[model samples]
Target: MRVMAFDYGTKRIGVAVTDPLQIIATGLDTVHPNQIIDFLKRYMQTEQIERFVVGEPKQMDNTPSQSAIHVKGFVNLLKKTFPDVPIEMLDERFTSKMASATIAQSGMGKKARQSKALVDNISAVILLQGWMSKP
Candidate 1:
């Protein structure tokens, strides 16, 4: 079953999708918050997504981050809109930091690495990879 991952934010949402075999996670695209549901609806017409993995941001002490409130609200709408697709929340404490570092180490250059959209895309990839790694 193919699974999709999303790194949600107030301004932008990063997206990633697993291969059909569910072995590799690839960065898909970044969309504005307002366009996310429509984007997903179009994506659903083309791909058979079985589940959704949403990055659940948390503070260092394991408390929900301030931005998590928005994520929770989005989750509610997601459930109501796509009731057939199961959604799972995955801890996303350091995924952004890790994604930035990964981009920096990849020789992507300072300007590209500084792009929030790229960071979001990489964050989604990281989140999906983490989910795939779990036994």
Candidate 2:
């Protein structure tokens, strides 16, 4: 079954999807926060996604932050919208920084790193890949 991953943020939501065998995760796109629901609806209609994995933002001390509240609200919406699908949360402490580092290692120019959307989407892919690597 395919799995979808989300890197939720205030302004943009990053998306990623796993292969049918659940072996690889690929960066999809970054969607406007306001358009995420609609985007998910359309994506689900096209792809058979069995589950959703969302990044749960936490403070440096591992405490829940104000942003967690918004993420919880979004999770609630997802639960209500797709009651049949299972949703899971993964700790997202340094996904963004990791994404940037990955891009930098790839030899992408400074201008590419400036694109927050690209970094966000790549972060989502990393988040999903991390989860899939677990037992």
Best by TM-score: 1
lDDT of 2 by residue, 1-135 (tens): 799999998999999999989988999899998999899899888789889999999899999877999899999999998999999999988999999899989888889978899889998998999899888
Clash-forming residue pairs, model 1 = none
lDDT of 2 at 117: 94
> Which stretches in model 2 have alpha-carbon errors above 4 Å?
none
Model 2 weakest lDDT span, ten residues long = 40-49
Best by lDDT: 1
In terms of lDDT, model 1 sits at 0.95
Please provide TM-scores, in order, for all candidate models, with all chains considered together. 0.97, 0.96
User: Where is model 1 more than 4 Å wrong at Cα?
Assistant: none
Q: What is the C-alpha lDDT of each candidate?
A: 0.95, 0.92
